[model samples]
Target: MRNAMWMQGVEWLAAAASDPQACKREWERGAGTVLLEAGRHWDVVSVPRQLGLLALDILWYDPLRTPGPTLVDSAAHRVGFFVPPDPAGNWAGADIRRASKGSWVAVPPPYRSAGSVEWIVPPDGSGTLHPPLTLELALRQANKTLAVLAPVSAD
Candidate 1:
């Protein structure tokens, strides 16, 4: 039952695709990933991998907050977090990238984790997205933590 619930959540996410049936078919046929438009049901916020990891940790540890789906692209050294749309458009940071209305994001199947991109935190099937304010705060804290842990040296 638990596994079924997880798949249901994945299906909910796939429904965001332009062609939901086609998207599911791709995953069924062993496609590594599928492209989905952003800003309809949700938006994506991508950040440097290092900062993202830190932010993820911080979010997870917080008792009052629960982060939504999160993805990581190992090759690109970036991480993407799913959040509610439009409101996060103005979020700014040193290396943060927001995928809103016109942007397309490549999403791997819920079972795929060996490719260049994989989910660090998959969707829970509850349509729960990261609260923008909470996410911003976590990212800010992560940025500060990263700066202190690995200060750049001047040549």
Candidate 2:
């Protein structure tokens, strides 16, 4: 159910990406432009570790979906980190990685923190840090993030 709606929204985004005027309209709408919204269930479990750090296993699910994919569907075999949002509600420490397969990659949040405190290997190799966000830059960053991360991470 939710995947269908999300796919629809993605299709709409694709269409909007194609049309300059629609893109302009959406751009003008700015931060309020929510392409899609669905109910998400998350579990953040903390496990104590060495070095005065705790490992967190974050899992996510969508109860609304009937028999489709759910994001964060499984318990992590290892711990994960929690990422906080910036003032603009955008992730602050996003970076791009060049995959060994010759593709550009974007690491997910929590791992995208400002400093060097990663507990796990990032999605791609070490990603190139993203710059500050303007509206246009935010859109581009989102497109790239979705393009890279969704295929690999989205269920």
lDDT of 2: 0.26
Tens digits of per-residue lDDT for model 1, 29-145: 875888899999889999999999998999999787667999999999999999988864347879798999999999987666647999888887788888888889888988888
* Leading candidate by lDDT: 1
Model 2 agreement with the true structure over 70-132: per-residue lDDT tens digits:
112112222222221121323322232111222211112221222222224222211212222
Can you give the lDDT of residue 117 in candidate 2?
27
lDDT of each: 0.85, 0.26
Candidate 1: residue 84 lDDT (0-100): 86
Clashing pairs in 1: 9-125
Q: 33, model 2: CA deviation in Å?
A: 24
- Model 2 alpha-carbon drift over 4 Å, by segment: 1-11, 20-59, 65-87, 94-155
**Going through the candidates in order, what is the number of backbone clashes in each?**
1, 0
Model 2, residue 144: distance off in Å is 24
Candidate 2 weakest lDDT stretch, 10 residues: 51-60
